[model samples]
Target: MRNMLKATTLERKFPLLAVENGCIISKDADITVAFRVELPELFTVTSAEYETIHSAWYKAVKVLPDYSIVHKQDFFIKENYQPDTERDELSFLSRSFERHFNERPFLNHYCYLFLTKATRERSRRQSDFSTLCRGRIVPQEIADKEAAAKFIEAVGQFERIMNDSGFVTLTRLAASEITGQDGKAGIIEKYFSLSQTDTTCLKDIGLYPEEMRVGDDILCLHTLSDVEDLPGKVGTDCRFEKLSTDRSDCRLSFAAPVGVLLSCNHVYNQFIFIDDHAENLKNFEQTARNMQSLSRYSRANQVNKEWIDEYLNEAHSKGLISVRCHCNVMAWSNDREELKRIRNDVGSQLALMECKPRHNTTDTPTLFWAGIPGNEADFPAEESFYTFLGQALCLFVEETNYKSSLSPFGIKMVDRVSGRPLHIDISDLPMKKGITTNRNKFILGPSGSGKSFFTNHMVRQYYEQGAHVLLVDTGNSYLGLSQLIHNRTHGEDGIYFTYTNENPIAFNPFYVEDGVFDIEKKESIKTLILTLWKRDDEAPKRSEEVALSNAVSAYIELIGKDRSVTPCFNTFYEFVRDDYRRQLEQKNVREKDFDIDNFLNVLEPYYRGGEYDYLLNSDKELDLLHKRFIVFELDNIKDHKILFPVTTIIIMEAFINKMRKLKGIRKLILIEEAWL
Candidate 1:
């Protein structure tokens, strides 16, 4: 046993030495600066915007010095939603909403970028010389302090270039986040254990020729290491047909198939090794000459020479920098059956990108070691294919999963790919962040396309968060939700009124909760009466308009003085019939100028015992202001001239009144399929 070829442990071959001041130092004189990458949400960026992100990456990578390694590692781990049910302030629907998502599994993604400056000797090392294969560790001295300083400065510039694009943001990782504390695992520890959570305990790692295993989970890796396996022509973005139509194209990054679209617990590692441009060109030129010399032996050699010449010509003419690039997807599952399914899923996803998936078996350990946050210098060069910076950047995914809004006000939405519930703020947060100009939203779809369904979902959440929601829907789309709220509040809120022969929708325009009539309130009341009395084509006479305004003013004044008299259309009609007629007679107004009898008869339907006598005298006026969810369903009477216009005016007046009383509160008025 002692003679078993000097058994070496992972601790002896680990490439990283220590983390200091938020930087990772390696055993081979490599220093890596780490950052957490925040990308735009999936399905949100357009084709032009994708080019901006790609250009940002291209420019950012151009700022780094020769022999620098840029490694972007994205972890898509399966996680469950942990709802906080302990909050006491949650409403009944809100608590149920939270519970509905509890334990719901989703692929949680976290992206990281590592900028590593490797020593010249280490930069040129091959796969056989990786730390995983070497038992004796030889530490390289980092003698050039100025080079490290310059590299850090260049990294800072790289960050600025990416951030200034306004689409991508990079945040520098803190020391604690890189190398965590007692209970939490750091970035390096997480890689070693293949754990998604920071609080996971370190587990044992087993490496075999067939696969790699971390505790109970077995790994499956698929790599795009050779140019022969990649797509013939790559671009900044591709058309995603799952969420796109022929008329409307949805654009995503070229490598999106292997990104958030690939569900499961996985990691995507992208590497671009920036070697000396002149040196790589010289080597390629030398290789092309060799291929030319061997052309007499085989036609393949002639073809290879032509390809190399084109590469050299493009590099020299276009001033394109030569870089070595590699990308691979690593997935794992605890059950063998699930691991097989994950392997198939990964392969199919790669196939979706028009690439032949190569199931990588060997070099798994070394590749995993190189992905250690700060140890990017230890990556195997043999696994990478040579490409230009622009083409290499095309393979980078520019989007991530939708993150929940931090603001308290938002609607509950599901992620398109993951189906994870996301707290999305389509109104306030977008306006606050300057992402949108206003809170106005316009939804367009054919029938049965869930247009009203989405609006119902939105308003329900709005109502739960102390918002006053006034819905004027022609159909009964909001009936169930309004009923839910109505039952939950026990008839105190969520008032839903639909026109029926037995019981019609009604409201009191004259009743204000606070009994204070501002100019706008009085004007709204006047507009309601005007809408009721005159037809759409018939314009009221000037004298009649003035007389109606005076009557409303007089009734408002009488109610302000006397608390016993109710402030509704009944009292106002009676005051106009008996008291106002006597006043008109005293003023001796002529019958042609002002007809009191005609005015009373026109508005008499809303009076005590007429056809719509129950319209304006509402006992529910006080609670209307406090009601958070109010739906006026006019499906039956939307075509009726009297009920439709009158009901809309009354509901709108109530909304206006609520807006005045509830000063800083949120109020939403959604009108769907009205007058349809």
Candidate 2:
């Protein structure tokens, strides 16, 4: 990790000699020197461990004068070096380079080791730098106070961007803050100041309070590098030692600047100049205002989706991190409180991908649809979409349950952080189902709640329009309507009825099985099936009917091997008889002893389980049934032992079969009194 912070400057050699207490160390100075020093906690100003640090400063010298050594260490230099800005130039340097160069250590393995050494050095020099007083630099260390003040002012002119408000990610902003030209130059000058003793002793040059006028408040802090390692030892502690709102410890120094201490205290502080003009504060406020404005929208919409793209693209280009988008759809219940809960929970996690009301009409209750960004791991997973929608749905439901008087048909993008609504529509494209001429309507209610009445009403209305109608009645309740419609209009040719008691409808292998078959027939069946399944199989039908149909289909697929043969009640009954006989023969049980009802009970599971799979699995076979929505029509069958389950099995199998055949039929399926 430490190596990740290596300097980009190529080596431009400068000749120098190491001196300890004014004595030269080594005569041969050809090699690059490494300095190891302790660093304050990241984003803080102090290292927990380490009194003084050790550094081997490398300034290339042609010859060295023999000198007593205070501290010495070996280091390696790449044979060739030049002073150009390239990472490779300092890639091989150790902690010593960071200390000598006075730059942030590279974030990599090498830099880690360098930080460790630097912290150790800081521990050793705790006493020496601690005694230095504020407003006083090490004597004879600097030339002009005004130049330093001007430089500090220039540094303060650099602005820090507000990351939370816009499309920018925190990590990207951090990298920018570290490497931008202004940031880099400030670091260099700060290091230069730290290297001078006179500059280091200046009280204002050390860590200055944010507001000097405060009687007991450390509002801010600044650190000059001259106060950090002025004695030329990486281990020397030249940091601000005492901190209180009171300026009582003006003379004491610690291992790190007061800015770092404030940082550790969770108080925002930076090593910038004190400008009474408040220009920096104004800029900060302006940037914040800009963010607030950009983040708001008239509706809950994605914040500058285009801007997000640009930000993510730039971040990726810089080899930073990843970004993604998420979308979800959720239905609302009558209870409004549930809706609000969903909104509160999920609306905060994402930039609203989309906000669609649950209901689009005044009479209908509202619902919600959300689209937001998700982590890369979440993309393409059905559950991810469900999670987003489910949570949001809960909130929307809760809100409606608690507060229903609000206008219902509104769409907006939501800011995840502030929960503010962005009213603009971010997703400009409208969702489309498909193109078709069929009319579809939903008649939803609990059992015995006039669902059939609603459906019959629609059928009557449509039939009166002179349009052809095919009544696929899964429930016998429709038989009365069929007769009524047929008798009312000698438009008898315009209506057709299919039920268990009625004539068997021919199965069309493909919706176009008969070249002239009306397209509306296929479309109606598809729409019906879509609705039934959308309700999660609560459609009314005898479980036995479903079983019988599946058993027949299963036996045909297993034996005659012609799945194309649509199994009716008789075919299924015969297949079950044969299979029962075979099983009895194998067990040596007399067929006379077998009870038909008991045997059927034994066979139900297979039909329900594996047969269901087969029915759903055969798309080609289902294509034949697309035009005919196979309704079990259970009203005439009084013996539920033979009727209910059987009807269910038949409808289920037929649905699976037709579903296999059906592709984009815009289908709706109805099951009246569906629960068993």
Candidate 3:
């Protein structure tokens, strides 16, 4: 069979005839194109977004005219093994033992591929008179001008949908073509070609068994079945063994080989061969007749009649369609020893899925039949093959649920159980109707819960995404993050404002720039003054509030007129002290009724030379909005009864003002320990 197959492929390039800009050209002048559909890191999408994605995919497929074959292949690699040549002083013995016995370290890799239909038309016109006389329909270019235009347009629509959905994809930039060594191309000759190698096992087939020397990897294809007891869903308990010894107590009752084939091209292949309804009914009737004929003979044999009767009865009652499914477990390794280890791991993983793999090594020609066009004959029929036949709904219902849980875009963090890098998408969570909610998150845990580490991770991701993050924290929680961001941005972005008694980080709320006295700032200053003077449980009179507002408004108007001088807390203090008396008299509030001296006394501490003088009396040099990341370390004043509230309110106002000024940028304000 190998010799016969070798004679068929007379092309130098085997299956690939030529490389084109948009598609691959095959030896038969067929035009085939491949694309990759990248799903978002988080498969969890809002209902509306799910609808949009589904609609887009449906539209893409619908736009293609009849006779177009769309092959979607998802290659899931769950593990990667790297051989250790130097394990101990006994290098040869240790290395050999570890390679065969030890569980190799692995990485999880997954990718999707979409192969377009192959155009079977001949590019060039035939000029032979005899052939023309026979009225043969000469094949045109594989994809004609009209079909190609539609395919391109559909592809563009799908790409836009993916991008809008926060997903990404890639396509082949150049055309790929196949060249045949012979005029005729065989099934195996299309994808595989003879390469010189020293391995004697495959030498007769004109190929090398030593994959390391040949630069090609071996693909072991297996048909998986008897999965009735296995988990029906994709991500549910797919891993059989826990990589961590401490987590040995965690185990699944039933598992699937969904993420088991680590570091190998594992394809969960399911083929739906929809039989004609009338033909199906006729076959069922014929089976019934055969069952009646076999009843007389069944009495002599020990055949379980009840089981066969129940099977046929359920099939008819459920109206199930015929569906064939098998998992193709493939491992590709250049090193022969490593490949053997991968194969063993794959087999063990399959057992956990209740699947015993019957190796297809002898029938290597059909290994890639599932991916190729017009090769459906290569797959074994459901009747002859060892397969599980059930209601079509049972099998097809789980098909749409085969998406991986890992986010498509994220940092690779190790999965605790598998020890494989799990790509986690730390982007904003999805809200209703496909809209992403604000990136506001809360971390609530005990003292030793690693809250700081988790917060730092999120902060770093936010900084990387160009978000303005302000961390109002105590106890130096974000000191390391601040330093890292500061170094990364070259001190242009991150600012760490640590408040100390000696070198206090001053935030003057009353400090207004020259010629900038807006109503908002005036109101902010009035609120701050009110908060400072009004004692707890002692509501300020409407008259007292009116007096304060009038005083601040008058000072702002007075300051606006003088562009040469800047207004600080000292300027406001002096103005309020002198103007409040006149303002109270104007409002018919006698001096005996309201003690204006009390307000003045309360404000003295935050004035030029008072106890809390450093806070509100200094110039406004630090601009919190301009910095991408800012950490206000308030451990010193965090315990202070008066200073803490004063500073917290001031910082909150600063962030609010900064956010108001910036129109479109996303900003985060993290007030840690708000209860404090």
Stretches off by above 4 angstroms in model 2 are 1-454, 457-624, 628-633, 636-639, 673-676
Candidate 3 lDDT, 146-216, residue by residue in tens: 76667566656655654554434544333221222344442223223222111222211222232211136
Winner on TM-score (1 vs 3): 1
The TM-score between candidate 3 and the true structure equals 0.66
Tens-digit lDDT track of model 1 for 1-676: 4564344567777777888778888888789999999999988899999988998999999999999999999998888888878999787777888899889888888999999998778877888888877877787788898989999999999999999999999999988888888888788888877765776576777777778888888888899899999998999999998779879999999999889989889999999999999999999999999999999999999999999999999999999999999999989889999988889999999998899999998878778777888878888888999999999998898899999999978888888777788888888898888878889878888998999878877887787687889988777888898888888778888788888887777777787767888987888888888898888998888988888888889889999999999888899999999988988899887888878888788888888889888888877665677778888888898788888888877787778777777898988888886334
Error of 1 at 583 (Å): 2.7
* Residue 555 displacement in candidate 2 (angstroms): 4.3
RMSD of each: 2.3, 29.4, 10.9
lDDT accuracy of residue 102 in candidate 1: 89
TM-score, cand. 2 vs. native: 0.21
TM-score for each model? 0.94, 0.21, 0.66
lDDT of 1: 0.86
Model 1 misplaced stretches (Cα beyond 4 Å): 1-6, 619-623
Strongest candidate by lDDT:
1
Per-residue lDDT of 509 in model 3: 72
